[model samples]
Each structure stands twice: as structure tokens, then as C-alpha cells.
Target: MNGSEFARPIVGLTTYLQQAQTSVWDVHASFLPGVYIKGVTLAGGIATLLPPQPVDAEIAARVLDRLDGLIITGGKDVDPATYGHDPHPTTDEPARDRDAWEFALLAGALRRHLPVLGICRGAQLLNVALGGTLHQHLPDILGHTRHQQGNAVFSTSTVHTVEGSKLAGLIGETSDAQCYHHQAIDRLGDGLVVCARDTDGVIEAVEMPGHDFVLAVQWHPEETLDDLRLFAGLVEAARNHTTERVNLWPPPN
Candidate 1:
């Protein structure tokens, strides 16, 4: 059967564990903002929340086996120690479980050759996971408060996408991007190329060429809620990938 004849492509999203409180219960729970899920759904993909992997062996690889795409979500700051750096005063405490889990998930997805999207903190995670470092604090480097407008809010910035880059092909060379992060890409990771940047020359988007799809952006695409181009690309790639996998299985057995 063709991919179009199948259910929506299953897109796995990495979530964070938070000490959540609600009218119903107060406990540590795995959760992600509805916006992320909503974005994937609106893009015609099936969204699955992938909480931190349990202690089972090969958890990430097993999960990757069932997933058509992977999304590493934005979250708390990555530990500076992971990338061999001294912590900056402004850096928040590390989301240890999330960092490790997402790293493994990314590795699994890469091995499986699945499309991956990394947003905001996820972009930083991609960099860190691929042997790169972060700036930790943008205010110190730029001496400005432009990248991050306010807490629990996003600042609008105009980023220039590289001409002829994959991102430019989808969203054009220039667009208004919704951004919220103090830490940005410092030393680029192996196999990653900058595709977009803000006026301050901060790296806003990165793409892993030669891969199916490995795009990470420092901005919040879910905030815009209208530009589904990137998400749609992921879904299409996932659909195509699912079709390929289904055809490859039971290899002449």
C-alpha cells in the first residue's frame, strides 16, 4: 500500500517532565505546550508525545523504529558541562533527563534516517548533541535585549535566510520570525549549516544538508500558527519515509 493509503505519518515529539499542578492533580508529569501538538496536527501529521524514555534497553532506537519523524522541542537551558563549558551566571539549571533523552532520540532518528525538527531550545540541543557549543547568554555578546523580549513571551525579529538554502526555498530569503531565547548557536556542529540569522547576526536557523530533513530554528514557529510550510515539509517527508519503510520491510524473506 502507498503512504497516502496509510494513516497520518506518526510524528514523535520529545516532551519535558514538569512539576505540574492543576485543579485535578498536582504531580510531576510529562507535558508539552499544546501549541506544539496542535502545530503538527494542523500540518496533517499524527502527533505522539514521547516522554523521557524509561530504563528499557534500546528505548530510543525502538521508538524510532515506529516513528516517521522526530521533533525535539524547546525547553530549559542545556547544561554547559555537556559541551565542556563553565556555566554562566544567567544560565538556568540543566534539564538533565530531557537533555539526555532528546540526545538519544536525535541519534536514533539520525540512524533511522528520519526527518527531524528542532525548535528554540531544541535548536540549541541539536547543536550540543552534535559536538557544538552555545553562547549561553546573548546579552553579553550583543550587549542588547533584542533576542529575548520578555519572559513567557516572544519577540519578533527579521531574519535573513540564506539565498538558495532549504529554508529559503520554503519560506523565502527574509521573513518575520518569532523568537525567544538568550542562548544561540556559538560554534556550529558537524554537518550543520546556518540557513538563517537575525539582524544581529545571531544564527536563527540551521539545516543538516545531505540528510532527509534536519532543520532546527531558534524561533517559535508555533507562535506564528499560520506558517505551516516547515511543518508541512516534515509531514510530507514523513509520509514519503513511511512509504519507503513499508516497502523495505520483510526484505525478501
Candidate 2:
């Protein structure tokens, strides 16, 4: 069957676990922005929300067994402790459970060779998962707040992708990125290569070599729904993965 004829790939998205109030109900909830869902659907993939939960390697593996791809969505700051650093004064309080949950899921996804995309905080987590460090606060280093303009505000950045990198091939060598990240990758992660960077020299994207699709960007691509190139690329890779799995172990007729 051709690509269009294949079943819609199941793309799992990690969500934020926080206190939310709706309809007179105030309680902790697992929720993600609608833009992320729309982005996945528009890219021709089935969206599945994976909230923060108690997950180990075994549990994560079971979850991956059902997904064709994984998206580590943007959210709160990752605990600096995970990378052997004390919390910066400007850093938001850490979401330890979410961090642990995502790390486990990421480990399983990597072991299973699943197509994975990370955005904003997702990008930072991916780097930390690979034994990398973060700058904690970009404003402190850049002497400006351009990377994170203000409360609930996203700034535009001129991002330059490395030539020949997967990210460059998908979004071109230069693109205006929607960014809202205060922390960024400080030390290079093992097996991960920088694929994109901002004009100010901040790492904007990274990917693990030899992986089918393991791209992570510091920008919030979901904010720009009009450009579905990144999402489409992920769904396409997921579709190919589905095809290969089916070929290797045909389903019962």
C-alpha cells in the first residue's frame, strides 16, 4: 500500500499535570493545549494524550507498544537537580513527577526506536535525558529577554539550521521560529548533535544520529499551526514505522 493508504499513525503526546478549574471543579488534571492536538491531526496522525503517571521502564514499554510516535510537549521547567545543578532564582518550581514520567517514557521510546519530537521544555528534557546540562536562564546569559519576551508572550527568532541536518531538510536552513523558552541546552548531550541555532548562538534544535526520527526544538512549533512541516515530517516517519512493523510481523487476517 502507498503512504496515503496506510492506517493513521498513533502519536502519543505528553501532557501537563496541574491544577485546573473548569465548570466549578478545581482539581489536579492532565491537560494539553488544543493546538497540539490539532497539529497532530492536521499532520495525518491520531493523537493520544499521555499524562504524567507513575511509569517505569516496563510501564513505559507497554505504553510505547501502542504508539507509533511520541511527542514530548512543552510545559514547566525541568528540575535542575536532574542535571546536577541547583535551582536558579528565576527558574520556575520543578515538576518532579512530570519530569520522572517523561524521562521513563523517553527511555522506552529510544529503546524501541520510536519517532519522537520535543518542543520547548521537551527539548530541554530530551537533552537532560541524555546526560546534558541546561543554562537555567537565558536572560542571564544573553543580557536580554528576547528568548522569552514576557508573561504569556512568545517572541520571534531567526533560527538557522545546520546544513544537511534533518531539521534543516524539514524546515530549511533559516526560519522565523516562535520561541518562549528561558532555559536552553548548556552542554552537549551524548549521541545528540546540534541541528539548529538562533542568531545569538543558542541551540535551537538537536537530534540523535542514526535514529529514524529523534528531533527536538527549543521553539514552540505548535504555536504556528500554519506551518505543519515539522508535524507532517513526524507523522510520515511514524507511518513508515507502522509499515515496517506490519511487514516484519503481519497481522492476522
Candidate 3:
């Protein structure tokens, strides 16, 4: 089918804390737009935004039920306590509401086997949700340079080793991804396999074997939509998933 023929895949993004008057949780408009632009430019799908609050199981289920797939966007650091680690001296604890919201949404998506693409902090959230742990602080624990380079926003970094996994195929190689994070995964979660790592031995990508499409990356693919391949891969997966579901059960008459 042509790209437009497929339904626009709705993708949710987790928000961060903002100060409109007081501390209100919010996601940037560009966050979803960037992801959507990449998907449309590459695989011909659309994205719909979802808030990062009131993360009730029922609400999450409803949200996932409408979308063809989901994209968990990046944000602040996750609380180390969630992964059994003592709080890092340099760690910035993420908003508890944002964490709760994303966690609930992730749980709902997994239960339905919905295609998910998580970036940066979103990747860490996926890992923690699946029973994994995080390093809290890469420089302090892993003894690596600041991965969050300020000179170039969304710039590429050193190459990593792709372990013959789905992500390798998506990006075409274990080349340098757009690095922008200070944390890394420590203990892996249940059902997740480390797909890529950097020179410092940091877990850069994780995937679930036999899943519809549960891929999370430490890099920012949305920021690099010029490389439409990654977005194309995700949109294509969502399209195929939608087609399969329709074939299995036609819409109610």
C-alpha cells in the first residue's frame, strides 16, 4: 500500500516539568512534531501527541488502543532509586508525575504489543520499566567524558558495536549516533537484549526479542530527521502492524 493509504500512526511523547505559573508538567510542541516530520518524510505515517500526566492504566489503555504505535521522547534523569541504585551526586531526579505517566503508558503499550520507539531518557524509562537498572551517572560510575556535548546540538559521536540486531539494520551500521545523555543502562531489564554499545562500554541500544517492535536508543533520532531511515523503519513497522490487525479482525459493522 502507498504511504498515505495507511492510517496516521498516533505516537505519544512523555512531557517534562514546566513553569507556567507554578510547576506544571508539559511537553514541547516540537517534540512530537519532530518525530512526526521524520515519520512522514520517511515512512509516510503521522504522529499524535499524548500528555505525560494522569497516567492511569485505563487512560493509558485507551490511548494505546487508538494509536498504531508509540514514541517515548527524552527528558530529565530517572530516579536511581527506581533501579536499586543510590542517588548519584550529579543526578537530576525527574519529575515524579512525568515518570509515573510514562511508566503507565509503557505498561499499557507492552501489554498490547504495540510498536514502541524510545529515545534518550525514553530509552532509559523503557529499560527500567522492564526490570532493568541504570548507571545513574556515566562520568562518575563509567568514567566517561560528558556524552552531552554542548557545542553541537544533536551532533554525532563515536561509533558503537552493533550486535547483529534490528537496530543495526535500521541505522545501516554501528556508526556514531546523535549522542545527548549523561546516563547509561547498568543492569538490563527482563526480556531486553543489549543491541549496541559505545567505546566506553555503555549500553546504547536495547531491543526485545520476538516483540512486534520494542526498540529504544540512547540517541536522538527525531533531531536527525534528515536521516529518514530510522523514522521510516518505525513507520513501516506501524503500518504493517495495522494491516495485520485489520486482517485479523475487520471493523465492527
Candidate 4:
């Protein structure tokens, strides 16, 4: 392989494993929005789709062994039980398998210090994985459904980044985010600090301190297409990770 090809970081993106309808048949499928792949590629990383599957710490570690970074793409609501809560009446039915799979993958990534970027449901999952709780239904708390307009439509959110957060360094102080989530971060996760929030004070971004790179956002960066700062940041970190890995294993002269 050419130097450029070998240097390009391999980033694993989580996919939705669900019933899907296409061309001539409907079946349970593993799929992801093209925008997620576009974002990663446009930012100079090789996109690798990782569908939900039977996984444990060892399996997740093996998976991470081939990846330089991880992106937890948006999907179904995180099961409330994940964070020690009962399901809210409006909550989406549990995708326990996906939850378990992703939790394992994330644990492996964290252990490896791989860069991670979580979006929407992904952001919620990160919080839950780190011993945090979620609001479950924003409309009930905010008294409006502005964060999510329903029926697969995305709403615009003006999020202001925290002054000294890693996210602020990449996307500046403010960003017009494309959001489609009905739940928001409630209690802060362990070692996680809020990096951005909407006008309503709903947490929009969170990051784990002392990690190589672990940032998750409530908004959908892929949907915004115009802004790729978040994806670019992830790719840059992953590239650095790749460089470090190679240096640690020198090829014989």
C-alpha cells in the first residue's frame, strides 16, 4: 500500500440493526445513514461500519484492535434500564442487544484510548455507559417538542460551546446544530463535562477528561453536512493515534 493509503486512519462507526424495507424485500438489516460515512471520509478517515452483534469485552477488544477510532451513530433510544431507571411511557422499546454490543465496544475503545465521537442516541449511550441518567422525554421537561419535531424531521438548535472545552476549540463558541432527540443528559457522567448546551439548558455536548478523545453530542453533525469540524477533529486525533501505533511497531529496516 502507498504511504497515503497506509496513513489514512480506520474509524469504526456503529450501525442500526433493525427491520428495513428495500427494493423487493423487507428484512432485518444492518444499516447506517450514508451521511455518517460521508462525514468520516470527507475528513480523511476510512469508514468501517460496525453492526450490532453478540459481543463481550474480549470481542470488543478484538474489534478495536483493528480500528483507530470509533463513532457511535445515532439510533433508537437507550433503554432506560441502562441507567437504573424505569421506562417512561414515551420511551422507545429497548434494543437491549444493541445496547450491550455498543457498551462493550465503547468499553474496549476507552481501554485502548481510541478516539470516539458519539452522536444523538450515541451521545445518550455514552452518558449511560459512564453512570449517568437521561431525561427520557424532553417535551415533558421543556413543555415543548422543539428538540424533536417528530416523524423523522430534524430541528435546528443553537448551541453555545463552553469556553475551555475541547469541542469549543474545534467548532468555536457557537454552532447551529441539527438535532432530533427527545431525551437529554440529566445527571453528569463520571469524568464527563458538558461542553455545549441549547438555550433551554439541555446538555448538547459532553466530553470525558483525561481521555485521548471522547466527545459526544446531542445534535446530528452528519445531518448538518455544511459543518464538519467535529468529524475533522475526530479524524485528526485518529491519525495521530495511527502514527503513534506505527511508531511503536517499527518495520525492519
Give the candidate number with the greatest TM-score.
Answer: 2
The order of the candidates by TM-score, greatest first, is: 2, 4, 1, 3
Pairs that clash in candidate 2: none
Query: Candidate 1: which stretches are off by over 4 Å?
Result: 1-6, 55-57
Q: Using alpha carbons, what is the TM-score of model 2?
A: 0.96
TM-score of 3: 0.85
Better of 3 and 4 by lDDT: 4
How do all the candidates rank in terms of lDDT, highest first? 2, 4, 1, 3
Candidate 3 lDDT, 1-253, residue by residue in tens? 5443467665555555544332574434323435544554456776566656666899888778887777788777887777777877778855777788888888988888888888888889999998898877677765655587555565466656465788878775667677888888888999999888877777888998898799998987777666776667777787777777777675668
Q: Tens-digit lDDT track for model 1 on 104-201?
A: 88887877789999999889999988899999999998999888877677789999999878889889979999888999999999999999999999
Per-model TM-score, in order, reads 0.96, 0.96, 0.85, 0.96
Worst 10 residues of 2 by lDDT: 1-10
**Model 1, TM vs. native:** 0.96
Q: Give me the runs in candidate 2 sitting further than 4 Å from their true place.
A: 2-5, 250-253
Task: State the lDDT of candidate 2 residue by residue for 95-143, as single tens digits.
Answer: 9999999999999999889999999998999999999999999889999
Per candidate, the number of residue pairs that clash is: 0, 0, 0, 0
lDDT of 1: 0.89
Off by over 4 Å in 4: 1-6, 250-253
Q: 151, model 2: CA deviation in Å? A: 1.8
